[model samples]
Target chain A: MRSVTAENITETFIGYFGKDTDPRVKEIMASLAHHLHGFIKDTKLTHDEWRESLELLKWTGEITTPERNEFVLLSDVLGVSSLVDMINSNPAATSSSVLGPFHVTDAPPMALGADFKRHYEGEVILVEGYIKDTDGNVIPGASVDIWQTAPNGLYSSQDDEQDINSFHGVFTADENGYYSFTTIRPVSYTVPSDGPVGKILDATGRHPWRPSHLHYIVSAEGYRSLVTEVFPNDDPYLDQDTVFGVREDLVISYKPQAAGTFPKEGFELSGKVDSAFSKIDFDAILIKK
Target chain B: MRSVTAENITETFIGYFGKDTDPRVKEIMASLAHHLHGFIKDTKLTHDEWRESLELLKWTGEITTPERNEFVLLSDVLGVSSLVDMINSNPAATSSSVLGPFHVTDAPPMALGADFKRHYEGEVILVEGYIKDTDGNVIPGASVDIWQTAPNGLYSSQDDEQDINSFHGVFTADENGYYSFTTIRPVSYTVPSDGPVGKILDATGRHPWRPSHLHYIVSAEGYRSLVTEVFPNDDPYLDQDTVFGVREDLVISYKPQAAGTFPKEGFELSGKVDSAFSKIDFDAILIKK
Candidate 1:
């Protein structure tokens, strides 16, 4: 038996898994053990501190459910999720961002120019975008799945007042690779701060707000999928998004339009809008796998 | 708003807690964020991998109960607990070791030279020890808490077949700083490997055995407490204790005695013993706070 010591424990742990058949698993476990032990040594953590950390972790797990994933939130707020996202991003493709915990798998499909502003009381906005390949050529019939929080700053999954797919839709690009939708203007909102992650934010005196953004996962049959979000260039929290999900290229200006102006072809306003509408003319570029 | 990016997320997280009133919390949080992001970057973790990690963490939390702490076990298996223990050890005092998750607050108190072998059926052993200050002066009236697994390799807390305090006892040092006890010889045992930690061990092809050892927490008024364990020098698993709880100075040899030989002045055997008994003489040195 090897007499285990603090100085040798890291090597011992890594050695124990040295025979892992999967190279990826071995690499990940080794790095994890190294960093984990390094952190403890750097901090000289005490029993009380260790106990508190365990308790915090337990609470983070306890607060997580199918609809709410506190661990992802924890990873996000700690910058881990964003770091991973950045690490795995393909330079040849659109920049990737944190795939937050709120994505719904079965978003309602809609026509290219359909409006998702059912019973919404906020300013209506037209979001038009093109799906193109890196060669600047259009990829027609690409799937554009998008979701955002309601004006009240709550995701449809988080609020019972909204329909299951409120402010969310899946649209297929037309033959010209164009897709458009009308929905409530995105507003800056705070990430869920009512759980263990929230406790950390409050303790650190950090704001939990994420800038107004629209999530998108665009895919075409022959191209690599892009999972990213578009941030409003003027949102106050753009610099300090709680989940660090913003990317420079993903930030775009939301052009202001007069209340009665129609930006897209064959589009009509369904509600009596008296306020100016925001129009975002964003385009996505996908890489061929 | 500053567009968040992978390059700046770590600094952003650290800055969020820069104004923490408590310097320790700030330091710990900053270091945690740094190492966490570093690990993610090193691994280039994928979205699927991130989701798997979250699920594993959730299962780890779900399996934890008041009696069983999977998080602590996670720490122990990863060498984190032992690292923390070594970091906090006082050089002048007895070396500290991992406080395995089996300690109980309500251990039964016993007089000096009492037997803890209630209904135990294994080779008998005599454990005698002294508690002293760094100056070699005897420290009387010190509380010595000890616990160990039964010969069957199961702690009283982990096994329902044994009574709550079987193989566990608390004793007060005599006027001469002497303490003695009788119990069955401890056998090497495996750490619990039925949860998330077990999954890792299995995947890594690592055995979960911890060498035969006796847990002890000795403390006196006006003196710093010592939380440690004594390992049998000859135990086959001494070098590879699963929790890395072993210290060089804590390992001692157990001398063989004829079945009828009595080693101490006030020692008495409570049950019939036709087999040889092992005797260990060990001493503990504590530091004054």
Candidate 2:
């Protein structure tokens, strides 16, 4: 029998899949096998360690549900999601960010200047942004899908206290490429830490807080769709987002606005606040497909 | 907020766990983050690819159960288990091999020259081996744990048709440092190929056959335990073990013995007189702790 040593194992494995008809699959498997073997070799991984790693993976898998994907969370916390986003992102287009695990399809479509916070109770904020192309031309009829956690730091999907679709909406840019919505200012909150990924954070002493941000997936005809997030500059976790979703171009200041100074065209002030209202203006840029 | 690019994401992630109280966890997390990010960057992975990868991980995890561990099998098929074994193995001791997923604790102990195949229906074979130290001195009372698939190529644990503990036993070497057991000649078999690992193999056109071999875990007082396998030199799959568990020194020739030529000390001639028996002689060497 041929002796299979570490020195020859890699070649043997790669050879097994060398004849794969699918080039992409072949490429992926080869690279995966190579790096995986290299990591084990570099770490001089012990049998006990190997067992622990396998158990970790098993636990991670066991906790994954359609509503809560622990594997995606693992990829996020490991910064792999961000790396992949950066790699595939078009530099000339709006910078991309991590598409966190909370995005849901078929979000309720709302008219421009509508309120997404139907039952939310927090500091009200008005967000206005324009959808433009790299050439500075307005992209009319662009779709902007937005979602964020409630003030209590739990997403509408995760917290039963909030109404269905609270703090979530899909709006379209008008002729002027302008879209506006009224909602509560998002609060920085910890990522779900009750599962295996959370256990990893706790064991490593890594904080699980993600910066307060709004998730958006912007798209229009003939333009590349951009899935990203906009972060407030003042959040403590701005630089320490557990998922590393922050981008310089994606951060904007939430300027304080006097109660009467709120835009009358798209927003209605509901409360007399001393310092509880803010306004943020940002723009989304997309590249031609 | 700082723009999180591919280049900066790694540093940001490593910094999160830099203050980890456990240095080993810190080291492992940092290395894991680095390589994981490196792999993403090297592959220039696309968003679709990332999603597919995440989905693949989810499926791999979801399919895992107590009876079947897809992650460990993944490690095995990818040659990661073999590589880790090589890294941790003592070169001076008996060559180590993959501790396949079938080993179970609390195996029934038997006297020397016991028959492990209580209900087996195949060519009878006698396996005799000595337990020795690196210095070649006999290590009396050494424990030799052995397990293998039955003639139908299914391990006792996997095949319901076989009785519990069939083709499985733990024996002790005698004062002469010798151990013997009677079993049916092991037939080459395929690893379980109905899971995610098997799917990958099928997609890649790689066979899942492992060489016919007997699994052994040998240990004695004052010596480090050795976990390995012995393969019949003539097996066609010896060079193609799916898990890459074969080692040169672990392969032995099984001499065909006439019915009456078999050792009478522990075995009984129950079959015809032609060529219904085989004898294999091997030895196990352990390193001093």
Candidate 3:
């Protein structure tokens, strides 16, 4: 028996991976153990700290539900989700962001330029974006799935009174890859602060607010679909989003248009618009698979 | 906003720690983030892998209970616990090993050399050890808390039929730092193999068997408390203990003694002569705090 010591324990652990193990799994496991052991050794972690970490994880799991995956949120607050997003980013395409727990794959289909502001009280705003391939050609019939929080800064999934698709919709782009919808403008909101993720943020003296933004998953035939979000340049939390999900290229400007200047063609709010509103225009870019 | 790229995201994450954050916490969190992010980036972890990891943690949490701390077991199987043991080990004293999750503070007090063999059936063995200071002076009245699995390869905590103190006791050293007890010999056992930890070990083609051993938490009034374990040298799993907890210094041989040669003084089994039994003598060393 080669005496097991702190110095050789890492290698000894990796050595347990046998010939029958998958090469990739072995590689990942070895590296994970390497860094994990390194962190423990470097910190000289105390028994109290180690047990506390386990408690944190237990708390995270205990609070997790189908509606709120605390684990995903934990990964988000730790910047792990963003790091993974960045790892898989394509230089020629739009950068990806966190797929927060609120996304429901069954978002109802939306009509182009339609508004869904009847169920909530908030400032109505126009959000339009084009879906294009890496070569800059508009991808007709591309689908854009979008969802945002209500005026109260809670998603439909989070608000018991709201329908599953309250602010979520799947809209098809036109021949020019143009899609538009009017809804309550998304507001900067704090993440769930009553959970373990919140405890970590509190410990670090970090705020829990995410920047004002719209979640999007845009896809078309024969392209690597883009999973991203568009952040208004003026949002206070843009640079310091709680989940670190923002990218420079994904930041956009929201133009405050006078009531009379609101687009009259194909817009649901054309006839009812008697007040000023903001407009955000972004182009969703995808790489061909 | 300093645009966060794959390379700068780690720095941005650390920058979130404010002045009010504990300096040690910041250091640990920063190092954790550094290594965690590095692992993700270096491996180019896929979205599938990222989600799988969250699931793994969730499963681990789901299986944890007051009696079964799966997280601690997870740490043990990964060799983190052993590393911590070595980190805090004193060179002048006996080497420490993992304080496996089975220890409980309420072990019943035991006579110095009494046997607890009536509760179970297996090969009877004598485990005698001395507790001394670093200067090699025996420390009388040093309390030694001990526990071990039964012949069925289960600890009292793991076996429902066994009482809480079935194979557990707290024995005090004599004026010369000598302590001894007789009990059913422990058998090598596999850790819980139906949980996420098992899945990890299985994926790596690693066995889950730990070497047969006894757990100890020894302390003297004026010395540092030591939590360690001892293994028989002849055990097949000694070198590759599933938890990597074996230290050469803590391994001893269990010498077979004929019933006629068993010690009679201060021993419960002295009158009930048996056929054959094993005897192991070890001396535990401690460092004064």
For candidate 2, the per-residue lDDT at A172 reads: 93
Worst 10 residues of 1 chain B by lDDT: B263-272
Query: Considering every candidate listed, which one attains the maximal lDDT?
Result: 3
Off by over 4 Å in 1: A18-21, A271-275, B18-20, B263-265, B270-275
Computed on alpha carbons, the lDDT of every model, listed in order, comes to: 0.83, 0.84, 0.86
Report the C-alpha lDDT of model 2 over A1-289, residue by residue, as the tens digit.
Answer: 4688888887888777746458878777777877888788877888888999999899999988888999999999999888888888777677889888788788899998887777667878889989999989999999999999988898877889876677778999999899998888889998889998988888888889998988899999998899999888888998888888887888899999876665475654454544678888989999898
lDDT of 3 by residue, A121-181 (tens): 6777888878998889999999999988888888888899788888888999999999998
Please say which candidate is ahead in DockQ: 1 or 2. Answer: 2
Model 3 residue runs over 4 Å out of place are A272-275, B271-276
What ranking emerges by lDDT with the best candidate at the front? 3, 2, 1
Which portions of model 2 miss their true places by more than 4 Å?
A18-20, A268-274, B18-20, B268-273
Deviation (Å) of A5 in candidate 2:
1.6
In angstroms, the error of model 3 at A217 is: 0.8
TM-score of each: 0.96, 0.96, 0.97
TM-score of chain B of 1: 0.94
Give the CAPRI rating of model 2: medium
lDDT of 2 by residue, B13-115 (tens): 8778746359888777777887788778877888888898888788889888787888988888888888887888877777888888788788889888777
Best by DockQ: 3
